[model samples]
Target chain A: MNIKELHRQYKKRLAKEKRWIRFYQLLLLIGFFVLWETASSNRWIDPLIFSSPSRIFRLLMDMISDGTIFIHINYTLFETVLGFILGTLIGTILAAILWWFPTLSKILDPYLVVLNSMPKVALGPILIVALGPGMTSIITMGAIISVIISTIVIYTSFRNVDANYLKVLQTFNATKWQMFKEAILPASFPTIISTLKVNVGLSWVGVIVGEFLVSSQGLGYLIIYGFQVFNFNLVLMSLLIIAVFATLMYQLVEMLEKRLIKNE
Target chain B: MGFLIVENVSHTYFSKDAATEALQDISLTVEEGEFISFIGPSGCGKTTLLSIIAGLIRPTAGNVYIENQKVYGNKDLSIGYMLQQDYLFPWKTIEENITLGLRLLKQDVDRGIASKLLKDVGLPAVEKKYPRELSGGMRQRVALARTLAVDPKILLLDEPFSALDYQSKLKLEDLVFKMLKQYNKTAILVTHDIGEAIAMSDRIILFSPRPGRIHEIFEISEDIRRLTPFQARSHAGYSPLFQQIWKELERLEH
Candidate 1:
C-alpha cells in the first residue's frame, strides 16, 4: 500500500476544512462587527463601559504601537513556556518513579485523585502564600495542574503496552533498561505527545487562573482590570488573545506529535 | 537421558480465591537436532510445557535439562521462542525485528547472516519493510528469521503457522522444512494441524487434555522426511501414515 495515498487523503480533508474555516471566519467577523456597531449606535450599552469593536481596534493599535500589549503578552507567554517544560519534566519523572515502584504508585493513587478533584481556586491563597505572587505563583500553579495530567497519562500509557512485546523481550532475556527502551518508551510516545496536547489547554487555564489570583501583568490581569474598571471590550480582547495563543500552542504540539510519530 | 530432558513437572496457581493446577507430573526427552511436534486438544498444558522450556514459567515439580545441564533458574540467554501470533514489532522494520534477538545477545550480527536468512526465506526485498507492510505469511517468515537469527540450539514454536491462509500455510511449511533441514536445529513445533505435524516433524507427541501427559509418540521414516509437503501428500505410504495419525487424533477428539 502506498502510504502517500493515505496522506493524500488527509491533505484532501484539510482542503475541505480550510473552505469551512474561511466561511466561518468571514461570518464571525461580519456578525461580531455588526453586533458591536448596532449596539453602539442604538446606545444599547454605555460606550465607555463597553467599548465597541472600532474602539477596541483603536486600543489594540495603540497598544501595539507602544508595544505595551506585546511586553505583557511576552511575559505571560514566557511563564507558560517555563511552566509547561517544568511540569512535563517533573510529571514524566514522577510517572517513571511511580511505575518503577508499584507499591508507591498504589499508595499515591488515591492522593493523586484527591489532588486532582480539589478546587484549584482554593489553592490560590496557598500559592500566593508560598510563591508571593508574580511569575512564580503563575508558574507553580501551572506546573501543579499540568503535572498531574501528564503523570496520569504517562502512567496509563506505560501500563497499557502490548503484552506480546513484553513477552518477546522477556524471552530474549532482556535487561530492564532494554525492555523500557525498546518496548515501553516507543509504545508510550504517541500517548505522551497527546498528553502534552491536552496539557497545553490545561496549562493556559493554570496560568490565567493563577494570574487572576495575583499578577500585575498578563492577559489574565488585563481581564480582571477591565472587569473592575467596567471595560467589556478589553475583557473580550484579552480572552481572544489568550484563546489564540493557547490554540497556537496546541496546534504546535499536534504538528510535533505527527512529525515524531511519522519519523519513528 | 536425551539431549534435552523434562523430568516430572507440575504447577498450581494459588490465589486468594482458589488454587488451579495447570500441569502435573510431566516428563519428556528430546534428542539433539530432533524435529518434534506437540498435538493436543485445547487447554492440554501444551503451551504450559513450552513456556517452562522457554523459562517464562517455572515447573513446580520437574526439572528441564538442556545439553545435560539444569535449565531452571538460568536466565542466561540460551533459548529462542516463537509464539502463535507473529508478534512482530509494528514500529520496527523487518530487519530490525529480525536482528532484535542477536542485538540483545551482544553478538556482532553479520549483515551476511541477516541478508542470507532473508534470501533463504524469500524476503530479501522486505528487509527495510515494517511488520504492517508485510502479509501474514511474510510476517511469520520474518518471525521465523528472527528466531533463527540467534542461531539457537533449540527452537520452541507455538502454533507458528495456524493463522495463515491455506496457500501461505503450505508455502511456510515448505520454508520451515527447508530451514530445519539446512540448519539441523532441534525444533519443537506445537500445532493442532495433523497434516502439518505429519508433513514437517520427525516425531509427533500426542498430548491428552487437562493435566496434559504424553499419549504417544510416532516416529516418521527418513524417506518421508525427504519428501516436499506437496509430494508427501501424494506418497503411496502417506495414506497409512495419515491414517495412523488420524486414529490418534480421533481418539483425542472423543
Candidate 2:
C-alpha cells in the first residue's frame, strides 16, 4: 500500500484497540462482581464476615427506603464543601501575605513544616473542647490539612513564575502590585487550578476523618456505628457511598481545571 | 551634551560566594537617531551595558545620561527593551501584549497605534491569538510591535534575532531597520553576530570578555546605510568589512 493508505490503516487499527481496552474495563468490573457473588453464596467466604457487593446494595436500599442515607450524605457533603471553600480562601490569602512579607515567612516556615507533619487526628479532642460537639469542629478539622498544603503549594508556584517575564515589566518601571497582578498570578494560574483539583481530595479526606472523630450523622459516623454494632454491610455501604461522592467532587474539579486552562 | 552619554560606566555583580566584574570603565556617546551595535563573545557584559543604559541596572561607578539627566532609576525617558526570547505574556493575546507598556504607564491604549505597528512589523491579522499560537518569528514580530507601542525614545535589543532561523532572522532584521528608521529612534543592539552588526549599525563597538571593556570601534560610512541589509550585503566594501570584523572577533577569542 501507498503511504496514505498505510496511514489510514494505522489510524483504523488504533481506534479498534482503544474500543477493545474500554470493553475489557467493563468486563473486568462485571467479572469481579460475579466472582464475589458466587463466593458469598457458595460459602467459600462467609457472607456474615466478608459482605458481598449485593449485601452492600441491600443495605443501601434499606438506607434509601428509610431516607436516612440522604441526611448522612447531605451532612458530609456540606462539611466538605464548607471546608474546601474556607481552606482555599485562607490558603490563598496566607500565601499572598507570605509572599509579600519575607521576614514573616522566614519566621513561620519551620512552624508550618512541623504543623504539616503533625498527625491532625491528635487535635480532635482539643478541637471538640474548643468548638464543642458540632459542625464547627468537624469543618475546622477538614480545613486544617488543606489550608497548610494549599498555602505552601501556591506560594512555591507563585515564586516559581518565570523571572524573565517579571524583568519585562520591571524595565517599564512597573510597580510591585502590577508585577504580581500581570505576571505572577496569571502565570501561576494553571498550578493554582491543579492545586484545587488536589484540594478536592484533600478536603474530602479531612471531612471524613473529622466525621470519624466527632460527628453523629455523617458517612464516617455510619461506619463507626456499623462497626460498633457488628453490621459489616452498613460499613461497606457507607464506604461505597463515600467513594462515589469523592469521584463526583473530583470530576467537578476536573471540569473547573478544563475551563481554567482552556487557552493552554 | 550628547543625545545619550555613558560616562566611564563600570559594573560589578556581587554575590555571597563571589564578586564578578562585568563591565569596566566604558564610555560612549550616541547621537540622536543613530543605530549602534555592541559585538562581543558571550559573558562580555553586552547585555549588562544595555540594561545599564535602560536604567534597569545601576553601574558600580559612573553614570549613563540621556539628554543631560542621569539614567539610573529613571523611567520618564521610556526605554524599550527586547530580549533574545520574545517574552510576550502568554496569558495575554497579541494585542494586549503589544499594549502592555501603555497599560503599565496608565495611558489610554490606542488600538490604531497597535494595529499600525502590527502592520509595520508584518503581523497585522494576529491580534487575538495568544503568544503560544504564533511561530517564533511571528512572536518576535509581536514583541517588536510591543516595544514600538510605548513610543520609546531609545530601543535596546539584546540579541533579539539570535533565536530565530536564518530566513526569519534576515526578514526581521530588514523589518526592524525600516521601523527604526521610520520612527527615528536611537537604538543600541547587543549581538555576537559580526556580520549582522556590520549590516545594521552606524557604528560597531567591539568588547573584550571577562571584565568587558571596549576593544575597538568602527564607524560605517553613510553610503552603506543608504541601502537595505540585503542590498548592503552585496555592497562593494561588504566583504572587506566583514573580514575585518571576523578577524577582530577571532583575535578576542584567544
Candidate 3:
C-alpha cells in the first residue's frame, strides 16, 4: 500500500529470484573451470597471472599427495577457529561485564576504541615477544583483534534493547541475571548473530596476518612463500583455500543465525 | 481493609528541575470481584492510578494495601497487569508466552490446567503458533491468558484494546469480560473512552487532568457490562449518557 511496504515486498521476493540465479551461477563457475582446462589444452590464453583452472586443480592434487596442503589448511583453520571462539567469548564476557558498570564502560570504552584501531598485525610483534612465535601468539592476538569488534557490536545491540521491555522486567522485579537471561540475551540475539557474521571476516584477517607474520606453516605463510618464489599457482591456491575456509565459517554462522533468531 | 484499597494515593513525576503531580489524593476501594474503571480525558492519571494499584508504582506520599497488606516497598506477585500493548514475547509460541508467569515462578504446574485454560481463553490451536503469526486480538488473548495463569487475586487493565479495530475491540472486550467474570476476580480498567467504561465496569472513577483528581463517579448495575460495546452503544440510554460523559471529559481537558 505504501512505498516502503512495496519495497519490502519486492525485497522479500528477491531471495527466491536470487536462489535461481545462484544455481545458474554455479553452472557458470563449473563451465569456467572446465573452459580453463580446455583453453590451456588449446594453448589459447597465458596461464601466468591468470593461472589455468586446470593447473590450479592439478596443484590441489599435488598438495593432497604431498600432505602439505592439509597441514597448512589445518593450521589456518586451527588458528581461525581458535581465534574466533576465544574472541567471541572474551569479547562477550568483557563487554557484558563492562556494560553492567557504566563507569567502567566509559573508562574502558576509549581503550577498546584504541585497541580496535590498532592494526591486528601490530599486535603480532608484541604477542610474539610476550607469548613467543607459535600457534599461541597467533591465535591470542588474532582473538584479541577480532573480539573487540564483536564486543562493540554486541554491546551496542545489547545496550540498544528497548526501554519498555526493561520496564516490564523491572515490574517483575527481575533480578539482573534474570533480566539478562530472559530479555537481554533473546532481544540481542539477532545483533549478536550479525556480529558473529562480521567477526568471521575479522577472524580470517587476524589468522592470515598471524600466519604471514611468524607462522612456520599456514595458508598465509604458503601465500608468502609462493610470492617469494614467484609461483603464481601456489599463491592462487592458498588464496582459494583461505576463501573456501572463510566462506564455510560465514555460512555456518549464517545457518546458526537462521536457526536461532526469531522473526522479530 | 477492602480487597484492594487506595488511601490518599497520589503520584508525582520528578524531573531534574521540578516535580509534576500526576495523581492527587486519589482514593477508591474495590470488593473482591468488582469490575471498576477509572475514566477521564487524556493525561488524567487513570493509567497512573491503575499502575499504582498494580504495584508498578508507589505514590509519592500515601499508601495502598491489598487485603490488609501494605504494598509499597514490596514486590507484588499477587496481581495481574495487562497493558495497552499485548507485550507478548514475539519469539515464543503462544503456549510459551502464556506460561511465562508460571515459568518465572519456577514451579511445577499442572499441564492439564494450562491446556484447559487455553481452551477457556478460546485459543487451543494457538499454542504452537508464534506471536507474530496471530492477529492483534489473538495476541491480546494470549497476554490475558498469561496474566491469568499467574492466578492473581486482582487484574489491572490499561486500555488493552485501544490498538484494535472497532469490531475486533468489541469482540475482545466481550470475550475478556466473560472470561473475567468466570474467573470472578477484581479488576480496575483505565480508559479514556467513557462508553467503554460504562459498558464494562460496575463503577467509573473520573479524574481531571493537570494533577489528576477524582472528579465524579458512576454506578452501573449488572445489565450494561454484560453486552458487547457495540451492542451497548445501541442500548436505550446510551446516547444521552455518553453525551454527558463526553461533555464532562471535554470540560476537564480545556
Candidate 4:
C-alpha cells in the first residue's frame, strides 16, 4: 500500500484502541456500583453499615432538596480554597525570601525540617484557641501544613535551578533581580505548579480536620453529627460528597497544569 | 591597541580543603575582527579562561581589558559567551530564548533582527518551537542567535559544537564561521579539535594541560583565510596544519 493508505490504517487502529480503553473504564465504574447495590439489596452485607449506592443517592437528593448540601459544600469549599491560595502565596513568597537570603535559609533549614516532620493534626486544638472557632480557624489550620510543604518544595527547586542558565544571564550583565526573573522564576515554575496540585489535597484534609473540631456547618460536621445520631447513611453520604469534591478540585489543578505546560 | 587583552591571568579554584590551579599566567591579545581559538587537552582551563573573559569568574592573579577598561566584574561591555551545551531556556520558544539577553538588558527585542539571525543560522522556520522540540544543533543555533542579539563586540565560544553529531558539527562550523566573518565580530573559541581551530580561526593559541599556559600561537596561512570551514578542510595546507597541531598536542600530552 501507499504511505497515505498505511497512515490511515495506523490512525484507525489507534482510535479503536482508545475507544476500547474508554469503554472499559466506564464499564469498571458501572460494575463497581452494580456490585455494591446488589450486595446491599441481597443482604449479603449489612446495609445499615455499608450504606449502598441507592441509599446514598436518596440521602444526597434529600439533602439537596433541603438546600443543606449546597450550604455545606460552599462552606467547605470556601475554607479549602482560601487555605490553598493563602498557603501557596505565603509559601512562594517565603521561599523566594529564603533563596534571596541564603544565610537566613541556612539557619532556618533545620527548623523547617522539624516543622515539616511534626504532625499538623496534633495542632488542631491549638489552632482553634489561636484563631478561634470559625472559617478563619479552619482556613488557618489548612494553610499551616500546606505552607510549610510548599515552602520546602519550592525553595529546594529554586536552589536546584540550572547554573548554566544563570551563567547565561550573568554574561549579559544581568542584575540579581533580572536573573531571578529570567532564569530562576521560569525554571522553577513546573515545581510550583506541582506544588499547587499537592496543596489542593493537603488543604482539603486540613479544612475537614478543622471542621471536625469546631465547625457547625460543613461535610465534616455532618459526618460527626451523623455518627452521634447513629445515622450511618448520613456519614456515608458526607464521605461520598467529600470524595467527589476533592477529585473535582484535583482534576481542576490537573487541567490548569495542562494549559500552562501547553503554553510553555 | 588591541581590542581585547588578557594580562597574566591565572585562576585557582579554592575549596575548603584544596586549591587547584586551572590556568597559569596566561597572557594574550586579540585584534579587532580576529577569530582565535584556544586549543588544548581536557584539563587545560581553556573554558575557565573564557569564563573569566566573559566576567562570569574573576581570575586569581590578573585581569582582562576591553578598550582600556579593566574587567573587574559584570559591566555593560557587551561580551557573549556560548557554552558546550546550548543552555537555551527549555520553557521558552526559540524566539523568546534568542531575545532573552535583550530582554534582560531592558532593550527592545527586534523581531526583524531575531529572524535575520535565525535565517543566517539556516533555521528560519523554528521561531515558535521550544528548545527540546528541536534537535541538538537547532538549539545551539538559537543559542548563537541569542548571544548575537545583544550585539556583543566579543564572542567567547566554549567548545560550542562538541556536543553535536559530526554532520551537524561540520554544518554549524561553516555557518558560524561565515556569520562571524560577515559580522566582523571578534571571537575566541576554546576547542580540543585541531581541524576546527585551523578551519575557523585566524590564529590558534595552543595550551598545555594542568596549569593551562600558552605553548605557542600559530597564524593561519593567508590562502586558508578566504575559504569557508567546509572548503578550508579540503584546501591543500589543511592537512599539514592539522598534522602540526596534532604533533604539538601529542607533545603536550606527555
Which candidate ranks first by DockQ, i.e. highest?
2
DockQ of each: 0.52, 0.72, 0.27, 0.63
Docking class of 1: medium
Cα lDDT of model 2 by residue, B1-254, tens digit: 67999999999999999999999999999999999999988889999999999998889999999998888877687888999999999889888898899999877887577777788899758888888999999999999988888888899999999999999999999999988998798999999888788789999999999999999999998888877777788889888998998998899899
List model 4 lDDT by residue over A1-264, tens digit each: 999999999999999999999999999999999999999999999998888999989988998899989999999998898999899989999999999999999999999999999988789998889988898899998898799999999999999998998889888888888888888887888899999999998998899899999999998899888889888889999998888888998899888888887746
Interface RMSD of each: 2.3, 1.0, 2.3, 1.9
- Better model by lDDT: candidate 3 vs candidate 4: 4
Residue pairs whose backbone atoms clash in candidate 4: none
**lDDT tens digits by residue: candidate 4, B25-108:** 988999999999999888999889998888788889998998788766746688889999999988888888888888877788
Query: If the candidates were sorted by their lDDT against the true structure, best first, what order would they fall in?
Result: 4, 2, 1, 3
Docking class of 2: medium
Clashing pairs for predicted structure model 2, backbone only: none
lDDT of 1 by residue, A78-109 (tens): 87878887888788888888877889999999
Docking class for model 3 is acceptable
- TM-scores, all candidates, are 0.91, 0.95, 0.87, 0.95
* Model 4 stretches astray by more than 4 angstroms: A1-9
By lDDT, who's the top model here?
4
